[model samples]
Target chain A: MSDPTVVPWPRPVSAARPESVLTVDDILVRFQTRDASVTAVDRMTFDVRHGEFISVIGPSGCGKSTLFNVIGGLITPTSGLVTVAGEPIRGPHPAIGMVFQEESTFPWRTVLDNVAFPLEVRGVSRRVRLEKARDVVAMVGLTGFEGHYPSELSGGMRQRVSIARTLASEPKILLMDEPFAALDEQTRLLLGDKVLQIQQTLKQTTLLITHSITEAVQLSDRVVVMSYRPGRLKRIVDIDLPHPRTSEIMTSDAFGHYVAEIWGDLRDEASRGMAEAEASRGART
Target chain B: MSISRADHAPALVGAATLLGLFALLELAIRAGLVDRYVVPPPSDVVASFARIVTEEDIPHRFAQTALEGLGAAVLIALVGIPAGLLLYRHMVLRVAVQSWVAALAAAPLVLAYPLFLVIFGRSAMTIVMMGFISGVAPVTLKTLEGLSATRRVLIDVGRSLKLTPAQQFRLVLLPAAVPTIFVGLRLGLVFALINIVGLEFLINFGGLGQLINELAERYDLAGTYAAIAFVVLVSVLFFLALERTERWLRPGR
Candidate 1:
């Protein structure tokens, strides 16, 4: 079922542009489980431009997260290629920073320490890392909670710490997988605005995978709608909105138009995904 | 900070219960409800303890046993921890050593005491050897477990940061494995103590266990009971000290 809040847009046929920062050429990922070989991502292809915030919206099993993983070099693709800045991504690159969906902040570490982790791993001096970590934490508006461990922080706060950690690494490319999805609606919206603001200020090239249409519309320059199971990119809707976007923009006419258009593109894919999920559930039962 | 009486209650109750049990046993022996020869009265045990403290040359024996145990523990940790890390770093070595180490760990060190005696003789050497054999397994196992269990994400973080293998081990693997290694060390110490005492008793080596054996042979019930109690107290104290040390050393605990 499609969300009733979607406002449809005039369909555009060609939206592809040049000057790509990240290019995924026919990437395929197969998981070798105990019983079966499950294809998570199937020959998916797309390009993200430099300094562009691209949000990938897909059904539950559409391999958006897997794509992010492959991009981050956490997992290797079974077949095909992924290139960043014209170089094949064989393993995790320092230039690419990842913020996971689940709060990945180290529970034993304080917010500042967690942010400093990437720098610490690089053998950067403690004082410099701490200073940079402080700057990033303040950038995420988590200035006062620098000394608080992840366990002491709320989920939204923890996510902010994760973002700060990623930013501390100073990676040109950022890959985030539903970073704000675990947060409450109000917190999600607030964090979403902060993230957009930071990305705008830094001009970071980001690939965000989220199911929230409003989130994608508010933050991303282009929203890539994906189909489930053997996931493929269906369409890329460009949001020509200016940066430093706020919660108010979420209520704008352009925002509504983008949401409706992306929802329309995702409608059939979402139903197919739901049916596949139900059948799989039945099989398991 | 304000102190609470409730916080101290469990400890007080525990101490009182132990004293009460000792008093009950002493009364039973005094009343002829229990055999006085087999089970010494609390007063007699106390007197034996005082004799060990003031009159008998027990301090020398205590120092000897402590030195042997500490030396064995140090040697075991130094040798075993690195060996375990070597296995963790090399898959082929790990596969080759897995079954052998498992078998060695499972086999009782008591069964090997006679072999140690033949090789090292019925001296402190045999006791130390026994202690080393008993303690080494836990340290190796714990080190291996800790090294292998390091988070893949952390490793990736290290790789992304372009850290050398040595640097990665130093910064990430060492800190991550410390808690697990400490657990192994604690278990190894317990095993070493048990083995040391058992070997000393079996081989007539001079330690508290040897004292217990000597007292038992001459039918010195009070002395034997006193020695046994001393051994229990030492073991408890050793473990408590170790627990405190571990708590202090553990980062962010």
Candidate 2:
């Protein structure tokens, strides 16, 4: 059940590497229900440097989301440690923000209010926070949608609002949990491009959990491949592709190479996960 | 455009059907196909309405009934909402108390009005108390449901924002729960209005109910019919105001 691996060449893909901003050490998560005690993420470890874009690619149900929660400090790991800015992360770190897979925009609030929510909670003055929020709203290219409700926006636009809301909070790090999983490829690509552009400007450390190889290659500085349930780090593939990357770069051969390189490590795990799911289904039936 | 039109069609059809039925009834009464004693003619009802306020001094009765209804509504909201928040704050309390709250809704609370009468005595307080006891449960239950059903992801977002528990509730939980809680309020309003007016009618205490009782006792059929019409009008006005308040609390409902 233990799959321990070491990084071969731990060199920064970016020419100038910033200090480590967030660290996860030997993280383990366990859930106890009536029938069984389940291990979701086990002995996983990684670090995110400031301004680094790390995409964690895993098979479905590989505990990528659970890891995100653990990192966000919403769920404390059953064992091991998570730290942010050299502080031992205890609970719901304001320095770290999260974008959920499902849309999390407040339906009752307009786009402006939703984006301003974090700052509003901090008791920031309305005139200043709204001005700041409007800028983030514009940065997300949702300038004219300030008055629109979440119910009025398309799925892609709603996710943009979600991103803007988190970004406006000005967290030092962002933990995005399969943010584009619900959107169609076209919108996903467009949002991915915008995310890259934002990251380039803001230089916030980002950890994105995604299954899409194309997304992983296009947006990440380095892609970490994760094994199936009781998740372990299978490989960390350095994406040597240059910065300020666009969704259109996904068409390039270099991007294809990175995708294929990561997929090679993932294929075995994917098949294993599928078989495990089938066996569990059979048992239930 | 298609979506808005689709949504409004039912309302339009319902309004049209109601008008058609009223017209048919009016015609039947005019043609003497229906007994006037059984059902007053539409014109007579309208004529009675014209004289009701001044002749019966119905403005005072109307105010009295409305005041009691408002009092009952206030009690329902003030007591019910907090009770719901309390129930939802702890799973143990919710588990122990939820069934009792739900059972109160269907427990024939009307039968216990006599006991309330014995306790509160024959007054408006009895009516208001009855309404509060009968109506509070639905609002409380709905509050619990709304709060309990608030999306976990939203709570996570609140956590990530470093919101204190009070701030989380005010900013996140309250807005999310308002729409569902408004539904409970409306249900409670229906119960409160019914109990308040019904208790008045039973006790012959004050307001429209007492007026209707005195009118029927004298066999003043036209005035009785007119007074009951006013009662229906009162209920309609309450519903309209409740609808507006709900929309104000949770806009675009």
Candidate 3:
């Protein structure tokens, strides 16, 4: 099969440094309900090195989002510490930026304005921000369409705009919550290539929350698998794929091996997740 | 971006249907198929427009009604929009006052013109106040609804950016609520105009409504119909201006 996800442009070579940029130490998140207190994340400990791409894969109810939120400082952990470059995160940290799963591009803003939003909020000068916005917009291959509104862009393009917006602030880490979960398989693969290229270009440290086996193996330096809720660390599988990765590598034997290994780790947890989901739904009715 | 012929179809059809109805009324009256006293010939009504302008001083009356309607609209936007924001800001205030605002929208507030006249004392203030009360509800309710209806994800996006509370409201919340707020504004204007004209007719104070009452009392059917036409004209003009403003604010919509 031909690979459309591979862009024609040359990718700059950059290696991940051994120094840890983000550390989540024994993080726990618990939600209290009228009936019972639910533990969402339990003792999830991990460290992301500078310029590493990490994908956390799990079953649907595996609390990947809970962990993602905790790391982003959106949810205060019931206990444990989250630190960025040794500094603790009490709230939304300046060192981290996030992309949401849902459609998040401001409808009122054009492509340039949407990308410039973070800078604008930081009180960056209009001329400087727009110039920086133009550069990021070009980086995302959305040049010549800066004036187009979110409503005018395709789903993939809007997600690209979201990515550009986050990158504008030059955060130390990027946290994405299934940013391509809403797109189809083909678009997902294409966007994965785009994201891979951008990450390589900027040498950005990224943590992706996703359920896709192919995506986990295709983009990650390491895949962290989680068990179903009460989510916990299952295993961390290092992807042995080559650098400057593309969807073309998806057919390789190493990539297939990683997919199967991660799938093995997830299958039992996925079944458990489904059973609990059914039980809770039945109780609701 | 290009306007096609099909895009204009509904408007063209509407204009044609109205002209056809007017022509039918004109023919029926002239052919003696209908009572000329009750339903004046369309031709006579059209001719009476010039007479009313010359004799009845229609310009001043039109201006009075326009001014009252403008006053009500200004109050609706200024007081009504801020009231909505305040209500949205305070959950306690919103829960306490939301249902009453909804009830106010449904109430026949024009009937309370006498109460307004007593308070503001038999002047333009009375008419404007009546209109303002009648019109304010939709603006308040719609504003509340619009703010409440903003997607949670958008707010999360703003929060993730670490935006201050004021910046979040001004940047994310207000702009997202705008299209729906404009819906309320348009509806509120319609209600305000109706109450303004209705009160004018009731109090025999000024504007097309008072002119309609005077022409009817004089037993001039053509003049009454002519005055009614001007009232319709005012409503149409108001709607057009509002739509223009809305389009300018949200061009993507």
Candidate 4:
């Protein structure tokens, strides 16, 4: 079978970096309900070295999203800290960009305006923002869609617009929350390759949250597996694979071995989490 | 399936049905199957309509009612939309005022006319106040609902961009709130019309409703019917105007 997720562009080489771009240090998050406080993330710690692409894989409700929210400074951790470029993440910082699972291009804005939103907010001149937005849109292969609204575009196209919007800001770290989970499997693979190609070109530090083991293996230099709710770190596996990774890598022996290892670690935690959730529902009834 | 001429078939049928009803009413009166004194025949009604258009004080009454309604709509849009936005931004205030707002929305503004009359005393002010009271609640409620209904993902995207509070409100919240706010404005316009006409009738104020009352009291049944038809035509025209305005404002429509 032909490889589905291969892009035509040549991957750019990265320079050696000594320091970490992002660090999550022993973070804990708790949500207060009327009846009781629920822990979402507990004592989780991780780091992404400069120019590295990391994937986080866990079952649904494993607090991976909460971790992303904390890292992006949308929500504060009840305890512990996160720092980007050695600065404590006090709140939403300009250095980190985010793409959500749901494609959220503004319905009222044309693709170009949507992409240029961050620059417009920062008081950049209209001419400068438009020029930068056009470059990003072209990079995402959406040059002809500049004047189209989000509603006029397909799901895959809309997500591409969102990626362009994120890139227009030129942030060092890109945090994605299951950004392809909503797309069809084929579109997911194609966009996944496009994203990898973009990352190779820009060398931005990226953290991706996903549930698919294959996706984690395909994209990451390292994959961090987390346990179920009140989620704790389970294991971190280094792919140590060659750069400009391709779909052919998925069929390799080393890739199969890592997938099996991660599955073994996750299987019991997945069942336990499911049973706990069901029990909680039953108790409510 | 491509939408073409077939898509407009329903609207064409509806318009034809309305025209048929008018014809049937006119024929029934002409055939003396219905009393002309009670239901003035369509020809006589049309003639009366022409007379009102050419000679009667109908134009002045229409202008008066329209001015009051437009003024009230502006006031409601200004006060209610902002109040709703403020409530959306402040959780404690929302919780505190939600029930009160609901009660105000549900209460009949017509019943408050006596109170307004005491304050403003049976003038254009009284009519405008009635319209304002009737119009404000829906705009406020709809604006609040729209603001709250903005998707979390969009807000997350805005946060990631490090947008200031004002920037977020302008870029994300305002556009998100627009369609719902337009719904509110549409509802408010209807309410304003209803209240303005009701106040004119109740207080003997100078508007189309007052003209209807005067003609009815003088036993000029044709004139009264003509005045009522005029009111209906104005309302239909107003709604069409609003529909066009909404389509113009909606991006990519």
Candidate 5:
């Protein structure tokens, strides 16, 4: 069942408010195997406004990544539509850029080259692309390391390079799939801050898939919580916090309330997910 | 400084071990603990190196083996890499032929020298062609392995950027696969060199293998060892060149 309640931005009424940049409208995704077909997502509907930062959180088995693939145009939904700037995505669209959780930086290329890869693929001239890449690199706080390779950088820095690469394309919507899941908590928090800063500066419309309630509360304007397998929107929690958010805001009572609210919604789905996982393992054994 | 020392440790130990083995063989032969005829004393082999260089016209023979091995390497690169790419590109082709190609790598290809001789007529062409077929298997198989081994995330990154198939290959897939492809290349070269030398010895035509055959027939055990040593040198040079090329292609690895 699709939740028809599309959350309105709680900002003060202003003429300068931006329009919707991305829409995930009534989406469903099903994967077929040798013996059975699995429904991963069902009637998933959400809209990311022009400059909103949103996080979608769910249990481990929830179809967050499945939904992300549909939005990124890497996979088509079994039914329904994903659009960027009102254009339906047939395949990977230039208006939608994605940063994966896994290490996606090419080890062979220098930071500058890695950042410039999207522009290069788009056939932008070398000088112009490098110029644009430099700007993104600096925005990601990876300056003075342009000549360095991914192998030389720490894991956090490499993720930054991945982000810079996507930003270099200047997509209308940025999709990040648990981009900090691989990092330690400390590094994740710091990188989360960097992402918040970058989003604030560029006003980039972003959707993040995360399992971390603290992360969702720390970075998102609104957090979409999803149910277990055959993932559906469980609730959309409004994170009514001030801008210029950082780890410091994580100490605020409002932040804790948001985290607790989302966690309260997630705990049951997580237990169901764990029980299903245990049952599957029992069957295999 | 410490890292450089650590890096050179294996090579230094290897050189020392080689020299120690030669010394041990020399001592064993002198003390009559081993037969000196079949395995000539290291000193005798060393002394004959000069004579082979001057009398047997070693330089020309060395050059011939090098050229044959080089030709095989070029052929392997040209045919094997594309074959790998084709296999990767088409699932049906890969499923149908990959196992057979893998079997070819393990097959006793050198025993089929008669067929190559019949086809190419006992010339360097025969040797080159035999080496090519023998070596090409590994290159093709490894190329497929390398391409297949590329991380899924990297391919997704390319797709997310809307890269074309060709762009994905060149910019993402190929570069990511280079180290593995080079492993395939190196293994192919070894196979190619072994076949080239063995075929030259069999047909009694050209290269260090021919000199090796002649020296053995003449019962010039020391000179035979000297020529075999030159064959080893040729193999070393080919590998060294391949290493240089790999480093050039994917630097700072």
Candidate 6:
């Protein structure tokens, strides 16, 4: 699989416009530390098309999260620009919803209420918000668990609530950041299947950040691989898979080839990341 | 666990301890191991409980203290919590005043009671004001802490959802900060009551503290002990009320 033939992946659907739905144009982000300034994303550029599922995969600390933050408009890049559907990314837009990696379900709220929060913030009435939220909860396979508190749910269920909450807002794009990283492998795959089903049904543009090769290949239409921090886009590998996917698809030789291909691009950078981390630790000691 | 054991264990342990201690004290005094007039036996204190209630007018005194404490508790909640939120909103204000507020919380604030007396006169106003001042620092500081300690990821979620700043506070920050704020309120309520009772004793004008002072002066040891026990009772009641409020506020937690 070291030099698997680069099969031309099909663009599942074309954007209505030429510029794409979301554009990251030469984005650069730098942090000023106590000792020195450090670059996180070095002039990164990408475009997520309408109704496309794009994944950013890299080693830990490879600025995948930083780029993700920049895309979500939580952090302003040092330079360059990001535009969603021809509008420049100013800050968080109502049209772009995000699912966080951490437990984002409000502990004080029941699952129904937690899912309804975004709509409530948007001033939607109780009857409408709950009705919409219930639909999304069902979409994530959490129908009967609506009245339960976040603490009552398992780790996987809580994440489902987070996803449902984000989806209830009816955003034009979904931004996810390692949403299943905390869950066990079995749950991750199951939830990944659920997410793929949701994406297929919604056909909403999505940009996901993950280190999971299987997840990126199984769920995403295109995977943007990044190098070690000061992250630069190393490659954009397309996963030429069919629609409405499941974890069972991973058993396919083509899926394995795609996974192995991503690992091939990621291996050296991952070890380089590890070496840098170790060197930093040694310096600190 | 059996139903009887599970249901009755907590109530029984406290009751059993009190009865055992009462018996021990009664035995010690009868055996001449302790003084009768100076350190009253459990029997003497129980005997005085009736007189302390009927003759000494414990209800009126209890009401006076409760009223002052209630007023101070209200003031602490009204002023302190908002002030804490303000402190949290302004990082410079927090850095400038957090240490001073913490030091004031730990201070023997009763030492500053003379100023309160001069300002509010030798009335219940003096005691209530003292209680307010004593309680405010802890409540404010704790509220600041609770608000400041909001999880970054939660805030990011709120922001990414396009929530306005006020909406973020209401839907996200407020709920997250509540458990810690409840803890602060508990501390503030207890602190306020201590200062209120102490002020009452100092002024000799109102409440159970005055009754304790008068009893002690007349060498009514049993009466004094009984009066002090009432203060303990009030504290327990305040604690239970706070617990109930916290549970109601964060239901099913």
Worst 10 residues of 6 chain A by lDDT: A3-12
Report backbone clashes per prediction: 1, 0, 0, 0, 0, 0
- Put the candidates in lDDT order, highest first: 5, 3, 6, 2, 4, 1
B1-253 per-residue lDDT for model 6 (tens digits): 6998989999999899989999998999999999897789988888999999999999999888888888998899899989999999998988998899999899999989899989989999999899999999988987888888999999998889877788888878887888888888889888999998888888897898898889999999999999999998888887888888877777536
| Models sorted by DockQ, best on top | 5, 4, 2, 6, 3, 1
Instruction: Please give the range of 10 consecutive residues that has the lowest summed lDDT in model 5 chain B.
Output: B244-253
Residue-level lDDT tens digits of model 3 in B1-253:
2477689889999999999999999899888999999999988999998999999999999889988998889999998888999999999999998999999999999888778887998789998888889989999998888889999989988988899989998999988888999999989998998999988889999898899999999999999999999888888888888888877766665
**Could you tell which candidate, 4 or 5, scores higher by DockQ?**
5
Candidate 2 residue spans exceeding 4 A from truth: A1-17, B1-15
| Residue pairs of candidate 4 with colliding backbone atoms | none
| Residues B1-253, model 2: lDDT tens digits | 9999999999999989987887898899889999878887767777788787798889999988888888888889898888889988988998998998999976779779989989989988898888888888999999988998999999888887788899988888988899888889889988887877788888999999888888888877778889988888888898888778767766532
Can you give the DockQ of every candidate in the order shown?
A: 0.30, 0.68, 0.62, 0.70, 0.75, 0.65
Q: Candidates' TM-scores?
A: 0.85, 0.94, 0.94, 0.91, 0.95, 0.94
Q: List the residue pairs that clash in candidate 5.
A: none
Displacement of the residue B109 alpha carbon in candidate 5, Å: 1.7
TM-score of chain A for the candidates in order shown: 0.91, 0.93, 0.93, 0.92, 0.94, 0.93
**Residue ranges of candidate 6 with Cα displaced over 4 Å:** A1-19, B1-8
List candidate 4 segments past 4 Å from native: A1-17, B1-11, B31-34
Per-residue lDDT tens digits of candidate 4, residues B1-253?
4476689889989999988987999999889999988988767877888777666688898888888877887888899999999999899999999888878877887988899989999899899888888888888999999999999888878878777788888889888878898888888878888888888988899988788878888887888888888777777777787778766656864
Estimate, for each residue in B106-156, the C-alpha lDDT of model 5 and write its tens digit. 998999999988889979999999999999999999999999999999999
TM-score of 3: 0.94
Residues A212-285, model 1: lDDT tens digits? 89999998888888887878878888897754578889877878888888889888888998888889899999
Better candidate by lDDT, 2 or 3: 3
